[model samples]
Target: MSALEERNRRVLVIDDNVEIHRYLREILEGGAEDAEFDAMDAALFGTGAGPIAMRFDVTSVYRGEDGIEAARRAREEGAPFSLAFVDVRMPAGIDGVETLERIWGEDPEMQAVICTAHAEVSWNRILARLGAPQRFLVLKKPFDAVEVRQMACALTEKWLQEANLRQGEARTRAMLIAVPDAMLRVSTEGRCEDLRAVGAPQLELDDMLPGQAAVAAREAVASVLAGGPTEVFEVEREDLGRLYEARVARAGEGDALLLLRDVTDRRRAELAAAQRQLHEETIAAQAEMMLALSTPLLPIHEDVVVMPLVGALDSRRVEKVREVLIQGVADRGVSIAILDMTGVPSLDAELVDEIVATARAIRLLGAESVLTGLGSGVARTLVEQGADLGGIRIHRDLGAGVAYALRARGGRAARS
Candidate 1:
């Protein structure tokens, strides 16, 4: 025991017998021979011990009146006794039981043990009082002085340990509640035992989690408690504003810690990855579509033919139009070629010449080229530019162009 703490303990024994004082005095200063051995291991099996057993102090008084005076003095001095021993029957103005009441009125935490020759009466009245019955002990007549010392040492030690624990718990609570992390203590069944307002400010009471989150918390609650110090998990949740991901963890001796943090940034990065995947998918689809449109060659029938002219022009589609006309005639062997101008989105003077040149190319291939589906916007543009296209036939629709081709085909067949 530290000198300061040992000197601080005061034990007031209220009894009329002077020999009782001498006896109690010897017990209070008991040596190692007075201790009970290996008999109380039940309370220390799992808890860290030995460190808690080394500090204790004891004092004893011989008279009820004297004991009461000493108790009052101790209280006035601001360091009251930690525990007391009181005999029920005593030669004084008040009895031991009444003196106990007066003593506690001064220091409520003082532990007391009742010493008496008459156990029955003392016990009966002692149990009925406002003082906790468990705090008072019964000592029969003709008890061993050494045994009294042992009990005094044990009970006083127990009371000091309890006082220390209560004070320590209060201090810890102050620290735990003020921590800056979003932390909680969760039970084995996934119920939040306590909440610390850190990362998750809304984690109050029974509302720590919602929606799919509750289910996910349940899944990992067991793994935390599978006989380990702590465990961590990453999970997802959707709140009123957005989706969030979180990292949760368990800590402490019972595997009961729970902690959460907002992981919105991580989730956003994942979303961007998914969008990139979708973009790649769309590109793949468009490529396959272009391949399908180009499969049939020109004049696989005289009735239908399509030509796609493609290339990047100078802010225009010029060579694209010329290729369409040549493909329409040579490949389909049509008497009339419908010049597909759909791919030619814009034009300049050179682009216009490319369209006129395409008509000449169709004639050279032994097929007359008819311009079809020229958007009014493009036709007006071409007319304003005054491009000469008297050589090219004009049709409003592909069907009309096809009819013209068929008519010329009939004429050629008749000549043959």
Candidate 2:
């Protein structure tokens, strides 16, 4: 054992007689040839060899005042005496009762025995003065050595046990303080037995959760006690403008534990992400609709097709136009395809190339392509860009293109 553990086994002896202090020291701190050990060895083994002695550090004081001072000093040094033997009738200063009162005020865990030859004070008066029946003992003067040793061993063990209990309580308090949610222990009937807000600084039990919350919490607790699953509910505080998620679970013996966690920030983030996804989906649908309107293919006659170009025709829209024209010619099996640009606002070199490319694509599909709705500005743009519309028929409007396609088909029929 460390010296500190040995020091905790210390005893204090308070008496006016100098001889009483000497006797106690010899008995508590046993010598090599101690009479008590020798007697024990003789009884146990029928031998006179002294047995192993147990030693205790004993402090001696002549007066009650001096004994109280010694006890105070031991407490300050963190190595307090586990027990004190105080004489009831000390000639100087306070008596045993008064000295014990002062010493216990400083260290209440210190056990003590009153040493006296006469009953100078009544037992009721002594109990009234000390107010600790379990911690106080009475030992007549000229006490037995074996009784003293037993008292020292038992009281010291009791002191250590009580110290351990206090340390455990302190650790529990620290753990509760470090937790970041509001907690409550509620009975089966939903009565709040204990509540702690160690980490929730903003929570006010009185004002934050009042009548409605108590009712709801009790209902949740009832559900869990009925062998139902754990329950969770949201509580919104309009005054505080915050949201809390309350969880209730059975905690044995007809009671439940409630934990409330704040989740307003998390809820807001989820809402924002959902709104962004919806906006992107809406924009995609609108873009698809606009692409369909930009390239419209309609059959005007038997084996004839017409495509009208409209709006701003960027490179992306031009590619969409080419796809629609080729698919329409194959699906409809057209012999003549017409390009209409009546609704087009303006034309550039890029747009002129796109138009010429569409006409060439139609010819490659074994169909004659007729260009109609050729405004002066668009025709001039096609010429300036040197776009090649090789062997492609041109008309002023959609009416003229349809009439010429019918006439050409009639001429072919007559020849056959």
Candidate 3:
């Protein structure tokens, strides 16, 4: 900012003496002759420095009560006085010490200078009343103008620097709150220096994180400090059955940062999904093997083949039977195909129709279809369903069916 637009350096002067107020105004407001002041300033500071470039917005009050009110008002308006000059002997009203106490109540950070006569107020009394001597200084009556000027400059600058530092710290804390996880900064030896957790529960330094997690975190911090790459690892809470993900990275020259987030629910969901997929794949493989077992095609002679049908039949299984039987008859160039069904305990109308369709499909491929081992219930189902079992031979068992198939294939039947 330009010099004219910069913030004012505010100061408050509280004393009953009008001359004291006027003299302070002249000293702090730049009305003195510069040439004479320069020589004195050079002797005082041991260097030839010009007058302070910063300007002071000074407020003067004759009574201690009035000074307290003025300080309060200044603070409320966001332009608090950086320093206050208070006189101990205010005969008309409350003394300087009480005035300062009330004013500090309004703005505790305001730097103070207690102006008192040689023995008017004891330093012990002042220290006892104030408690923090670092915030105020004792300036005896008949103080030199140059000394007062130097004190004001140093104290006001100290106040401003401290205020800036506090603001910076506040901003840093706000940024840490924005992070949605537990965070800790640790020394190279694994001692936690700072901890912040806006999204999770707050953790203590001595207690550290928790259980095995604390040990893992310390190891991660050490690894990062030793120039190892950033590491991510999981720590499970056996008591709670919960898991956490911890990430460690170098924060600076001598410290590392560890961030932690809970991941128990996510891990559980992934494992469940994997198990479901594996179960589905296993069922599919078993179904394929069962289909093959139910429709085993065995060659009994040069031109004859026998297919044993077992288990309950659905539309899907019926289609599988058709595919295997037609493909086998055509590939083998067989003249006779025997279908044995001794293990089939029962049949429905739909299944009987599907069986007739399979036998007709075999006949279309230039093969004679023979059915054997038909249970009484299965024969009754075929009659009830009025199935067209044309151009197909029926026998009582597999041996009888194989003999018929071989005789129809122009080979003599071999008795088994």
Best by lDDT: 3
lDDT of 2 by residue, 18-40 (tens): 98888888778876567665787
Model 3: which ten-residue window has the lowest total lDDT?
197-206
lDDT of each: 0.62, 0.80, 0.83
Provide C-alpha RMSD values for all models, in order.
13.6, 7.9, 9.5
Which residue pairs in model 2 clash with each other?
none
By lDDT, the candidates rank as 3, 2, 1
Q: Which stretches of candidate 2 lie over 4 Å from their true place?
A: 1-57, 77-89, 109-127, 132-146, 188-208, 222-229, 252-254, 280-416
Give the residue spans of candidate 1 off by over 4 A. Answer: 1-9, 16-19, 26-78, 90-109, 122-136, 195-208, 227-255, 260-416
Which residue pairs in candidate 1 collide?
Answer: 298-331, 298-332, 299-332
Tens-digit lDDT string for candidate 1 (208-317): 67745666665556665665434455545544454444334556545455666556676778889999999999997775565434332355244445453333234233
**Pairwise TM-score winner, candidates 1 and 3:** 3
TM-scores for the candidates: 0.43, 0.61, 0.55
Q: Residue-wise lDDT of candidate 3 within 37-94, one digit each (tens)?
A: 6668888886635444444678999999999999999999998999999998899899
